[model samples]
Target: MFARSLGWIVLLGLTLQSVQARDYRYSDAHLHYVDFFQESEGMDALLKAMDQARIDQSMISGVAVAKKWHEDEPKRPRYYAGDDADAYWYSATDIYVAAALEKLEPRQRQRFHPFLTGFNPVDKNAVAHIERMLELYPGLWQGIGEVFTRHDDLTALTSGDTPRANNEAMTRIYHLAAEQDLPVLIHSNITSKRERNPLYLAEIEEPLRNHPHTRFIWAHAGSSMEIHRHQTRLDFLLPTLSRLLESYPNLYIDLSWSVLQPYLLDEQGKPRAQWLALVKRFPERFMLGSDVVGRFDSLSEQLHGFDPFLDALPADVAQKVARDNFLAVLPKQR
Candidate 1:
């Protein structure tokens, strides 16, 4: 009797493990090839992490600005927000990405979709820089951003006039992106931390309306870790996103880690019904991302966190959000 009961317990454990395992693949739609310090674990480490995480492909870009290590600080700040030191636009970031890719075999290189992000968005000359990068490295760059516009504290820490999504410079960039058939991933927060309304909606909406041809991937669905840290949730976020999706077909949403807690999953880590419905309504428009900076230790965890929500979604929609949606949005040629 004891042996029979033990066998049943062992069988149940295996069944549960199989049921919990992730069956679908993933394409990380958003990832930074470097950190704020303009450093990375290199392509080998990245590829290893991607393999471990089951990330078949990734949209990789460099951080636009490099955080400064101010003289007074005794120890180096671990992250950009650790100190008041200002970060400057580092054009070499794109070069780092290119170098990493150049080292990889052709088949391995195909796994990464490199995005150019080493220019100051507030500078009108930025578009020229982007054009030059494309010209310098033909058939290399697949997309144009993770453009830091109106980002939380990063905007203040960045050295320059705050970048707006609809600014003259970004407008020119958008035109270039459209002409080149490259998608633009922009991190423009929908509203300030204190404001419950979408105060910065126009900044992104203007470009979405004016540049209908340009494909814009709204990073973190206009939410950020900083915003969530300050406010429990953006109460207006859902309706605002729903309205935007209805209005603009060119728009896509990146479901990065920042959006996971306050929006995608609830207190018990169960999928929220409203968000599940929203994703189902526009299955093709949403994509998953690890959004990991230089280090990739958390890459698997960050992505697997979505499984609960994904499990709740319809099978087709779940597959799309997990991987297909991101691949679908990439440039047809590249």
Candidate 2:
């Protein structure tokens, strides 16, 4: 009885502390990830990284889950678009060559399905793939998207017949999330050279606007790497982010991948206080979004990692950036 009493006291004290810290590690939503590179059981890796970072919980989403529900997503198989090679947007594919290509060829598109070693859509041969993903991991995946708009070649998304079909299918999937009231973090970078801005269109913004409850997270903060990467200071992302944020109460931003080096640089290529302020101003509007993957050494570099980015934040800002702000905004988990 005495030991039991002692245990209760300790448990209560720990619980109180947990509440005090606001469990900053969790409640985070922007998990801009590379489903292609990271293992499917990404939550495990994420949780492990969070544990190290002392993050309590996280809101998660994925393309596989979204596509599983939205049947129109292009098949994981590889192929090529004929003729006009310049329109690589959805025309060509060479998994190994996507990085080498100057344009958005199918092969050069996102590796979400894995363009590096090999690529295959989530096993469609099996039972309802979407159901399997949900059953396989429930309560963990809060929403989906950040599902990059990529194709094996230009045709998968742009081919005469396919693009229309793809668009219709995505419309259905977006509605699915709306019905579920789950937020979606999508891979839309308005600033990339290879792709046109998604938000600039009416059809693309229609479903999301129609579904106000659904949240949207733009993975890249709307800036091309070549430009933002060399900044002396000040984020090129703010304009894009602020624009979206101003227009959509539900829109949000994530700082994943890129190691944030470009944003970290200043006019003369030096890091500065002004830079930190810009990055921090968006709390509750921003997230500790790390596309931290397994390929790199530091935790931030690890698949589903965030140590380096977390280390970059000021304590007060870090807490909010890491979790508080995200928690304040995420549509409550189902």
Candidate 3:
């Protein structure tokens, strides 16, 4: 499959004489811009890599990446890891989400996604706490998800068997987006995992299906982090994403970190061409993302930067993947 893809890629590159001209601000539609938790620290890592990749711009923001944390620790102290509701989580999420949009509702409308884990501040006033964040910062947060979910062992002992938060929050979040004509990005369960059930996704899906006008983008190819142990990755991910895409039109995907060699391989050690083919078939639904953390110096020469990947694309196709498609529907500024 690699040989076949390489042949097509080379031929595509050769045929496109204006590939260089296609090089411009490749607005990555999805980005974990700020490391509120300092856990993944993926925000800063992404920016540096973007510069190295020569990706001029991105629609990056802080995400509520704590679905697993909450489920894993449903008792005692909630662990809201990775900066969602906390003031010090990241620099500014409210600003980015409401940067250009006009009008934001008070309380429920402007609330941040709750991320309770072992150390969470308790549901004693979870919604109120998030409301306080919106009241104080205003326009910093958007919604939640890109929320982490996995089948790791330590978490297995703790995570919940049902959706954590109230459907009200999901409804309100959806209402807020509807009122403002915006989209919500959620972390849905794409891959089949008996150990980790993305029950919260049902909550999210309920609201999304009800409100047809509301748009939503499922991140990381609809497959969040998983305990690979020795399992085939794509064997599970591709079919899952493919099914979801087939199921929902409002549902979109961002090809964030899959550009690397790791994502292309399945549990059977076979090269999965389905993902690349999906992008080729539906360029508008997928966005380009380089999930490299830290700087380009982190991985020099052999891989170079994000450019070779973007550069390798057929010019017009790359442009669509880069920004145009996303910006077409996303809220953009100069």
Top candidate, metric TM-score: 1
Cα lDDT tens digits, model 1, 98-196, are 998999999999999999999999999999999999999999999998899989888999998999999999999999999999999999999988887
For residues 1-334, what per-residue lDDT tens digits would candidate 3 score against the true structure?
A: 9999999998988877554444455655555433333334333444466566555654544433222334444443333433222222222443443432224344322222211111111123334544565576454444334433322331233233322222444555456555544555554444344434433445445554776666676656655444243343445455555665676777677655543345644445344466556666666776655433212333222123334444545567667766676565553321
Query: Model 2: residues >4 Å from true position, as ranges?
Result: 1-48, 59-140, 150-166, 194-208, 224-236, 264-281, 294-297, 300-317
Query: In order, what lDDT does every prediction score?
Result: 0.93, 0.43, 0.46
Candidate 3 error regions (>4 Å): 1-25, 36-50, 63-166, 191-208, 258-272, 290-314, 332-334
TM-score of each: 0.94, 0.53, 0.57
lDDT of 2 by residue, 1-334 (tens): 9999999999999998655533234343444233332223333454456566554544433222111112343443211222222221211122222222223444322212211111122222212333344454443334554444432233243323322212555555556556655555554334333333333334335544666666666555544344334442233444545555667777666665443555644335454454465566655666755443221123433313443344455667767766666556544542
Best by lDDT: 1
> In order, what is each prediction's RMSD in angstroms?
4.1, 13.4, 9.8
RMSD of candidate 3 to true structure, Å: 9.8
